[model samples]
Target: MSRVRNGLIGRGLIPVWLLLPIVALFAVGYVLPLSQLVLKSLQSEGSWSLKSYLEIAHSPTFFWIVLRTLTLAATVTLICLLVAYPLAYMIARCSPRVASLMLLVVTLPYLTSVLIRTYGWIVLLGPSGPINKTLLQLGVISEPLQMVFNAAGVYIGMVQVQLPLMVFPLYAALARVNPSLTKAAQSLGSPPTDAFLRVTLPASMPGLVSGCTLVFLSCLGFYITPELLGGPDDYLIAQGISLRVLILGNFSDAAAQSSLLLLAVIMIFLVFRRRIAEELDDSSRFDDISPLGATASGLAARRPIVERASLLSHHVGLRIHEALTSVRRPLLRFFAGLALLLLTLPFAVVIPLAFSDAPYLTFPPPGYSLRWFSRLFSNTQWLDALSFSLRWAGLSALLSVAVGVPAAFALVRHRFPGRLAIYLLLISPLIVPHVVMAVSLFFALAGTSLIGSPLAFALGYAIIGAPYAVVVTIAGLKRFDRTLERAATSLGANQITILRTVTLPLLLPTLASAAIFAFIVGFDDVVFGLFLSGPNATPLPMRMWDNIRLEISPQIAVVAVMFLAVLAILGLLRLFVGAAIEGRRSQAKT
Candidate 1:
């Protein structure tokens, strides 16, 4: 038996057993269902045909739904971009401490489930809620506005929910901008506005493109917000697909709709990508600027080929430059503050309302007490679901780390076939919508024994969370020196020994980050939990979903506040660990 195992291991087949759970998941959760959906789309009344797709194309309601979804997505993307750009820029420009705090605010909502966040939106946007109540008190309007159950409500909820997705990418892009460029621009007699437009904006275009692409793509497949907040006329393609599958019991129609949305999304991204690539390529073709046009008067070559500063900047005296330009930096700062406030207010709103003495959801309560929070602890249903979610998160995080660590190792340490393709495939989940995955997985698991099982949910979440683990671990591993591993090997260390001492120690910080990210991905997921959860295994987000749908409850606010508190604690821990790792690395170098 030992020899047989060794032979299999030597043949690269031993690890196959370790992959059984993941392989079963990918095959049963993704491949089979997608295949079935495609096959179903092909079948007609009795035989294979394009009839289902044709029927969809021919329907006026289908076209309207498609148009509505696109419009809603575009509107939300634009609004999010408008709101996120300045905030991201402000955060990136601030001191490290301030930047870290700002980043925490932007990312804190990410730890809480989207279902809870959307419910917060519901409380804020409802007629009797804060916005309308304030407006009525001020006599801005005698009657309440029709904000909820309309496109307006959907836009607010979706944009607020999805803004972080846009902000982070743009922040990353903006963060990459060199401060020297801005200084050089100032020294060259180019005003800050001109400098920003001519230099900063062009450099940051990649981030904007990336952020917009990510936000728009995600918005395209949104289901819950639109369904919960919007009126019947506000239906998007995702809602249409759900209606077809769940209500109408027409799997073929749902498949066709999903396929169309997928195709259109791919086409749209491809077109935008080509346009940006062409633009960049065209910019690269431009020759050196004329002496007359050179804003930088001095061009000094630090390295042989690349100039250290622009031509005009080289001429401007490095010191004793003119007064530094500061544009309505304050105005921009104020707007950034307002945007952050708007993004986070729903969460803030929940805290105060959670303690309301009245059963009704009211702010500035007649009396405040901890009774509701006390009630939360005694609510067995809520407690069970929360416990279930925590367990699922822990399990999923472990599984994600398991799959991700190896993949990260392989990608960083080895050269293999299809490496880039595999990397893209693994991270592709981040770009795709949750509802699509939920629908696909729903169909895939319909007849399988794995359906409605905790193991199945864990596997499902592992896939969703795997990319985050990969991102964090790869970042950590990339920054790590491979020479340490080589030295260990040379000292007669085995693979396990080298990994235990050299690799694992260096990768600890990253591992922690990956673990946190994996837990967040699983804990915050709503669509998957909604689709895959059984009575015994229903995650907190799904339970919250049931509560919100069945009736409006204030206990959700209590839950939301607690969720945020846990996230804050986790985030702080991650920061401290990261700092300690950095300190150790610095000390070692010293």
Candidate 2:
């Protein structure tokens, strides 16, 4: 039996078997749907043609919408970078305990549903909401300002929603930088600012780039925030696609637009693919191929003009450094605190509003009561939506785990041909925009009776969620010690017995984390729910989205609070599981 197993492993059959389930899931759930969408885009009246693409190309409206989407994504990425850099730096510089707390604060908004966050902004920025009401009361403004339904609201909501994406990556990069390098630069007679720019900043460029890429790509597909906050002119490409399909019933045009958006996403991924992979694997050595080194090498070819510009910038930097040296730390702390406050502001607003006695959304309610929570629980539609969301999320998590764990094993434990291709295929769902996936899935499922069924939602969500599972499980596998497996094998244990008795138990904590992540991905998703959900299968986020658009009510706040509560419970559960795992490990060592 052992000889047979070894022979199978040597022939790469084991890895192939392990990888098969996930490959099939991706094919049916992702590739087929997307292929259908592409084919639909190229079809006109049952004949293949370029009509839709040509129509889009010739339409000035399409041009502006695409341009607007790009501009919005770029602008949001820039703002998030500016706001998150200081906060991430501060967190990195703090003590571990304090840093963890601050990091949680930064991630608070991110953990909350985008719908809930957007609704929070609605309550806070509405004409009669808190900010305007306070301003009116203080005579800061005589009348309420138009804040919510405009570009200002879109920026605020998007920045708040996406800020943590930027912060986490930046923090990871900053935390990895050697403090001694900065000190060494200072010891060489460089100012603090110069040392940071010359040493720390260059080292953290990978994180900066990764964060920007994530934010930009995410902003491109943003539907909930912009739709809820922006005026008509603020319509983005994602909104355009949604309108074409949902309102106009124009699948071909929507498909064409989706194809273009997908193309842009693929191009971006290809451009930054190597950097993202290196960052994820922690394989990049900053000292060897630093951004500064790259710049210097590039500048070597155009020395004279670049040298003069560099000297001028250096002189200006020195002067600015001298002037701001004493207050620099204070400024960084202040800005970081401000950014964190912005991140937490929605939670602070929503929690109290959840208890509002009034039916409408207003801060500092005339009286406090549990009316909304009662209504939320009593409402049949809300209850049904919640039930469906929970069921679908569970199924999605289960499917993700079943498919992802073996793929992780194959990728991490075996070497084979097409391994890289398999890995890329598994993670490609993460690169594709959610709206595009939603559209593709919709097109593929439209002809089937399963269109709005729980199975449909589960399969769609699993496609996206499986990537998280694979990535997390791969990390766990990389950390796992194979010596224990070898010991078990030497004791005459077969592969199945070794896996059952040793591997699964050791990987329990990581598997649990992966499941929780997958569940959250399914639960918080609004795009898939939007396109695939029917009257009978509506998810909670979809329900909340409807309430947000049709009416602004305190019940939505109750749902938002529920989301936070669910997040907190999951987080505590994760910590508990991790501690238990650690305790067992310690006991075993003893």
> Candidates' TM-scores?
0.85, 0.93
TM-score of model number 1: 0.85
Instruction: Check candidate 2 and list the clashing pairs.
Output: none
| Candidate 2 lDDT score at position 433 | 85
Off by over 4 Å in 1: 1-25, 266-327, 481-495
Tens-place lDDT digits, model 1, residues 88-131: 98997899999988987887765666777788888888877888
Question: Judged by lDDT against the true structure, how good is candidate 2?
Answer: 0.85
User: What lDDT does each candidate get?
Assistant: 0.74, 0.85
lDDT of 1 at 176: 65
